[model samples]
Target chain A: MIILTAAPHMAVWGKWLGDALGTNAAGAPAGNAVFGIFLSLLVYLIGQWLFKVGKGFFLFQPLFVGMVLGIFILFLMAKVFGTTTAEFYKSAYKPGGDIIFWFLNPATIAFAIPLYRRNDIVKRFWLEITLSLIIGLVVSLFFIYGAARLLGLNDIGIASMLPQAATTAIAMPIAAATGGNAAITAMACILNAVIIYALGGWLVKFFRLNNDPIGAGLGLGTAGHTVGSAKALQLGSIQESMASIAVVIISIVVDIVVPPFAAFMGLK
Target chain B: MASQDKVPQTETTEEKPSPIIVQMAIFAAVLFVSSLISPLFPPSFPVPTPVIGLIILYFLLASHIVKLRNVEKFGDFMISLIAFLFVPSGIQLAASLDILKAQGIQIVSVVLIATIVMLVVVAYTTAGMIWIRKHVFHRSVDVKS
Candidate 1:
């Protein structure tokens, strides 16, 4: 009910705001990218504010909430202003959004700091950690491939599903290389994160893994990616550190391993 | 090292980078080099440059070529908001609505189930390894001693 009422109002206000700022909602494509990014951040901030005041309404994770807000507003704008969704996304959203996406690799590289801080612990169990991530990596691949096949999805779906467990930095390229839609891979990655963010702690507790932060971190990072890592941070520094290492190792290993194996199996 | 108290207590003094320019320059150089080499592999078997960039940074730290204090703050700033970098991609899911509406539920379920199983499996494997190390390995060492 709220979304129904609020979306249209928000759309109208957003158009008005854009006009007041002298950027037409329907304008040349050149500046729309910058406006799109600004709009995304603005909507995200609003989502954050709403989450805080709503006491984490619906267990709202900020990124997911922000994505929903962006989608809703963009959809509403398209409907109200008579623009196609394709054009709006391409001209208005992708350019600005792509700038932020480019930074993702750097942000991932920055994880080296945490891994460095936890170097001693990592070294002590490097062998075990590596072994566990390899195992987790293999299992993740098989699970997705097997499940998608069982569900009767075609090659593109199977390819996208295979790398769903890894972060987007790794998943996107792999998906494209293996004949999957990169967008589907991104969607799968986000959905995977949402699953982990929502249920990760409970799963940790249920399995009595909370007592072992390394394992807990491995599990979270293996399946959850960034959102899982976020949950791990709440568990403790060990879990957070282990998760950071796991996320990095899992991505590197999957990148090296998935493609050749896919070809051998004749997977799309 | 996982425990905050276990790390040697450093007096809470802020250490500024002696030359922030050099530090930033090194990061940029590493990133550039990694990106250059990443595409050398076949497209079907591409390596992500960021992973290579991370390895270079890690080696730099491990070899004491760069002090943690020099790049630590910048690294922390980037990583802490790493998820923010992903928001745009998540929003881009809007572009694939037809595919999503068709397979969204199935995809979500697949993600949920696989993730849950993977989480359980990883947790138990780590915990079991810890147990074996503590009980079996330590017991054998004690017996030998």
Candidate 2:
């Protein structure tokens, strides 16, 4: 009888340990902060591996894959715990997720390194770069506004799409400030990047940009952001440098341009 | 090739980058100063602290106050993790699934068309400027090798 009682006590202790470590008695993930971080890191690594194994297929891109997988796992965890996905994300995932998100600011500051390294090209073509970026920025705003409205999206949707040309780091806050949804802005930015990465070479060929490294780089950086810059790096050193410059210049311009443009478009 | 030839010999002659700790310290210092300075801008027209940090680092590098080798390694490392850093934000889409499910196709189509249009327009505009610079102004710009 003593042994039988002790078995139940030991089982209780095991359940406690499992909960603390973000696993349940059944070995499924429980709602725990550390587990959230571990899940994100593991999922991202899986994404990287898949990208490699898939032979650089665009769908296998780490960020996209990690996101999809992470969300799916979170949904599964929520179901296992008998709670909603949003509640799980808030209680279990957010603490660790926010910690990882905090690094984005510092990572963004690192962009200056590339910009500084490539300052020579920027100095030479400042005029062309500025003119092209300004034109692109204006045109992008109008295009996004027109398209979003034509698609019957509301003001919030239009606001979110307004900053789509900027890098995710720069775009998200601008979207929030302009009454757009940051989450939606992030999706738009990622979608923009994936599309550009997949189609950048073909676009170059279609636009007859074979000899226009500067043009190609600027477009890639302006429209595609970091991923576009990555594509630019594969093209050539000059293109890489130019793309870096475009990323910075376009970001600053968007910061200045989006507020007034949004107001003019009647978006709060 | 012209650009490659123009790279200073001193750059190649420099020793390996500074230690990782030192590189990280430099970034930390720059970021700390940026955070302090960023709030001076009004909230209405917010300039991201990182952008301020970027400018500060640029000037520091341009003036040689901060050696490129000091920050290059760590900066590259941080940049390599950028895609990973963005994963959490992407996961936040789980919260907004309703919007996505309702208009997923529309959103995708809009982004697809807008991105392609932007790419073509920006590329052509830039190429047009380069052409005008070389032909119309007769500028003796060194053609990209």
Candidate 3:
């Protein structure tokens, strides 16, 4: 609304108020959580509306839409109100965004519910699921490292790329410890998520790999992480459960295996 | 008859938190515990707290300590809302656009290609393994029987 109205004056006043409250201080950490959440939600809704109206343009995934708009809004505000992007982000957005992000931790854990509910399928195909995930992990590592090397990425770059398919919690540290940039790994992880979410349905259609929910789930989870699992949930309950299982198992496998593998590859 | 029905309804209403609430509360508790324990691992250890929380939730459900019926609605709700929780991260991506632009081509291409390959390989491996187990190996036993 502020953006549409071009109310630079209102935005400036809000910044002044934030400053007055001393919530804008570095690391002391106080800001309007509600506004942050509302801002993201509004952007997401706009993204959804665009997708509905635009006939599903690939670039308009809600995540992409929200981030781009959020950035734009912040950048515009910084320009009008005479502040840095960093200052605006920290004071106006981080508190609420961080609060919501914390919920992602529990959300991941709550995955066990779907797994439990779908235990029959889980039990029946547990072995196949495990074997496929392990194979997929090994193969993906090979391809990621091989591709990075082929692209002339040095060892640190390969190490960062190696953990791209794993969950963020598991990927970031491994990237850092292996001499890769944490920021780069984080970016790679998010990119993996976006690519998978955007292309997953098309990939499934192109490959003619529909019908086996378990397979689809494992594939999505192995490659996509939380974003992939979110997509899987939209597919069906069984896919959701299987994807959750895949995510948990893959995270464990990557944590145990990637460190040793990184060492052998001379990452350290 | 009306009086008797009213008394029973009142008693049931006063009994405890709704099952969905209990389920959600348990999830929150497990998440809290997981966060508490995450820092104890070596600094290099990837805090596997989410997985740990999943394990705890599984046990609670399996043992009937947290009844499935009580929590299923809330769990489903959480699953549906998972993507919404990611909005902040997506927004946070804006902060790193400069870095993204610098290595964008390499990063995006590798992610795109690797993700596609990984998905295909995993789907095929899983589907193939299931087919082998069900048809080739299990068929032999069925024939023997």
Among the numbered candidates, top TM-score falls to: 2
Query: How many steric overlaps are in each model, in order?
Result: 0, 0, 0
Compare the candidates by lDDT and give the number of the best one. Answer: 2
Model 2 agreement with the true structure over B1-145: per-residue lDDT tens digits = 8778767755665766888999889889998998898788776677777778888888899899998899999899889899999888888887877788888887888888778877777888888888999999987556353
Worst 10 residues of 2 chain A by lDDT: A1-10
True contacts kept of each: 0.69, 0.64, 0.60
Question: With candidate 1 superimposed using the best TM-score fit, by how many Å does residue B58's alpha carbon deviate from the native?
Answer: 1.2
lDDT of 1 by residue, A64-170 (tens): 77788888877776665455565556556777888888888777777777788878877777877887776766766676677877877778777777766667887
The residue pairs found clashing in candidate 1 are none
What fraction of the true interface contacts does model 2 reproduce?
0.64
lDDT values, one for every candidate: 0.74, 0.80, 0.70
| Best-matching candidate per DockQ | 2
Report residue B99 deviation for candidate 1 (angstroms). Answer: 0.9
Tens digit of per-residue lDDT, candidate 3, span A1-268: 2221343466566546555433345554444576677787888889788878878776776666766787788777655645666566766676777787777676767667767866766666667777888777787777777887777666666777777666665566667766776546655666667787788988877887666666888888888887778788877866777787787677767766677678777776
Q: Which stretches of candidate 2 lie over 4 Å from their true place?
A: A1-32, B1-16, B143-145
User: Whole-model lDDT, candidate 2?
Assistant: 0.80
lDDT measured at residue A147 in model 3 versus the true structure, 0 to 100: 81
C-alpha DockQ of every model: 0.43, 0.54, 0.47
After superposing candidate 1, which stretches have Cα over 4 Å from the reference?
Answer: A1-30, B1-15, B18-22, B131-145
- Two-way TM-score contest, 1 vs 3, winner: 1
Candidate 3, superposed: residue stretches over 4 Å from native: A1-24, A32-35, A81-84, A152-160, A167-194, A208-214, A225-244, B1-21, B139-145
